[model samples]
Target: MLNKLSLLRNKIDLLDIKLLEILSKRLELVKKIGLIKNQYGLPIYVPEREKYIIDLKKKEAKKKGISPNFIEDIFHRVIKESYYYEKIKKFKKIKPDFTEILIISHDKKISYLFKNMLTITGYNIKYIKEKNLNINNINYLFKNIGMLILDISKNFFEKFIKKLFLLPKNCILIDLSPIKEISIKKILKIYKGPVLGLYYFFDYQKNFLFKESIIYCDGRKKKYYYWFLKQIEIWGLKIEYMSVIEHDQYVFFIESLKYFFTLIYSTFLIKKKISFNKVLTLFKPISYLNIFILKNFFLENPQLYINLITDSKNNIENIKKHLDYINNLSFVIDKKKKIKIINIFNKIKNLLIFNK
Candidate 1:
């Protein structure tokens, strides 16, 4: 029996070697494809092709009596790895239209991420912490800067608004604040140059830029910043143009409200003295997902979430209205108004379904 076990292990080791060789060959092909795509300024992610490959593999797996879900899980990881390798492969260098880009942010992680991403694409990038910004350094740094990215907190940006005159007149200014209303208003008042507001909707830690979404609002001259938009597209981000008021309104619903509910739920759990481990053992998928989101939220700086929730008066007022609605629902439930509650639920369900 021991000898049989040894033989089985050896067979598995041999199969692993073959699998590695196949993966290496596949990655080589992916790199070549990346090169060709870069040459033509094509995007890295093709959703249609990805969907076709996964569906095809799932069909083959079912015929072979393997679990289709198992095959799907494997292929998804493989495709994600393929995308990472494709992006890291040497890109066809495009000469940047701008001279030097300056990134100002209090957050080191965000600043460095931007610096690294732009630097790899052959753009000259400089970074300065918000604390380091002064009249002298601003003059020195803005001398050759054709593009200025403001990635600082909203509060800091407000305080720094008066110093906008230090920047060169021709430099394109881009704001990366999540809440756009205040920043856009303040910036427009101070700076007359080409301005753009960008809100990134992906994890900053992601290694590849494939299919990431960026919602941008036009602030000033579009012609001056057109090349900058093209540069971002070449790096594989999907851009959506929105008005500043519309962007802020959506952000209130999507980000501020979502985080507010998560916080309330977490507080309820804590107040009830619920054991998180016991909850995990219950094996509820939806609960698990909620817990996962809550855990991830706490991993980031709490101040970031606080700033997001309290950034605008509109967000605060909207959240209050939601709470009032919830209170009315609770009163209806207590009064045993089954017919009214049913109507309300149906209306909400239809709204959600119709939007989808």
Candidate 2:
């Protein structure tokens, strides 16, 4: 009986190997289909076709006395993989219109940082000093402008607003102004072009790397979005598309509030007359962790931080509502409920490894 059991186990292992080989062959065919679709300018994911294939697979599985749920799960995973491969292939085929990026800025530090970042990616960048940008000669300024970087001071933005309308209809705008949402809306009214608002604070000398910038577009332009995404990816930067309101709310809660609390904590520490060295010694683990975070994530640009806080202050009512919701949260632990939750998690873990 033991010999028979060993033989059966060996047979099962052989069958598993054969199944994996067949799946590999299937994935090769799927990739070929993805390539063909890309060549024809067709969408990679067709829900109707996917549903039909899955339904046919289910019927075949049922006929073979196999579980439908297992077949469905396997096919869903295959579909997901196909979608991912197809999207990557599509991005590889995109041809951007222009190569030169025109940056209009007076801030030497900020412009220099951007220029260096873009230059590494083989992008030809032209800098037009803010003083040189005049409303009278706006047309001359936009001669070969494919991408325009707007980084003017908030105080001087009013004069530049009207001149932005003269930008060629196809030119992409990257606005780094203080008030982004309002500025983008006004620009979109006249210049029916791609507009992106990028917000971040970074100072390499100070070891402050608030390198994560949130991006929001004025309209739904997939081509420009894809182009910008690829360029930023080359620079090792991260971006996500979100509504202006959602972006502001996220910045308010995540950044401004965190900075405010940090200030409050530091004030109390100073009041207690605790030296930096004493605090570091007292809370070695936490101090080390916070130092790492400050170097990696904290904003060093006071102007940007203040602007974020000011934006948050403008939405005080919404912030208060969220604060009230936070206050309502409880950390009470009930033994029975905790046990039930643990059991549910265990069941989920088991389900993940069910077939295996």
Candidate 3:
């Protein structure tokens, strides 16, 4: 009876701690929004952006197994309070709100995501339909706009990046559909494509492919491992230096090639349509878990999957090697080979958990 009471007390303590944590997060976000507005000279109350954010909250909540309506009601109250804070400024100095945010994209789904994500934060969001927006007039159009989110569609971006670069604001640019450019021209007497302008190169058209960088856009906006360190002066994050070309090559090799081969292998395994009971006996728990994660990621972004193959060098070699090893697997295979693979798996497991 005493033990049960102690357990209940512990649970209560945990609940209290979690409640404090959530409050802390809310306060921090409030401060961050205020700071960002101060730094960028933007307003605090933006209805359009707020609507977009609330929508995103609803969508994201559904994914995380939360009620969208609950998130919406909570955020609506939060936004109103924030607006009052900005307008009153009785407690402290408040920043002015931005009236315009221009998003360029052809995909309606992504536009909806962006629209909803911004509403909770309260900013004015705008869109210039790709077809209606003039390529040459982008510079003139951006004269008064505060923030610009480019979709990085090559056909669209190639015509106006130079002009957009001239805007005198804290422009945060993210390339959505970046083509990995080749870098051999300087030393090999081959053609090198321009990095930041109209002369951008893609891997599929090249005679000999090389990669320059790997760019990934997970849901949250954060820098990649290699990019953060190398660009400390500019990006001020942790990254190790590798040329964009090499990065793309590695991504193509590891991501593009491996995904294709494994997908094929998985398909074959399923095609035989063997009994689930039999398959479970042969399956490794760790392998099954890894496959589950990979399946989710693959389904999330087709562009990323395709880019991995079309954007790299040396991927084919790696894919073939792994596939050969996979195909050669049999119940009667050498014990030494089995042990080697097992040791490798153990090492990976250890390395992954060591830091955590």
> Estimated TM-score per prediction?
0.83, 0.53, 0.43
**Per-residue lDDT of candidate 2, residues 179-249 (tens digit):** 55666676677667787777654443421122344465545355765666655533323466667666666
RMSD of 2: 10.6
Residue 260's lDDT within candidate 2 is: 59
Q: What is the C-alpha local distance difference test score of candidate 2?
A: 0.65
> Which of the two, 1 or 2, has more lDDT?
1
Candidate 3 stretches with Cα past 4 Å from truth are 1-99, 108-115, 128-141, 153-172, 178-258, 269-304, 317-336
182-244 per-residue lDDT for model 1 (tens digits) = 888889999998999999888788756777988899999998887777767767788899999
* Greater-TM-score candidate between 1 and 3: 1
Predicted model with the maximum lDDT? 1
Which pairs of residues collide in model 1?
A: none
Q: What's the candidate order when arranged by decreasing TM-score?
A: 1, 2, 3
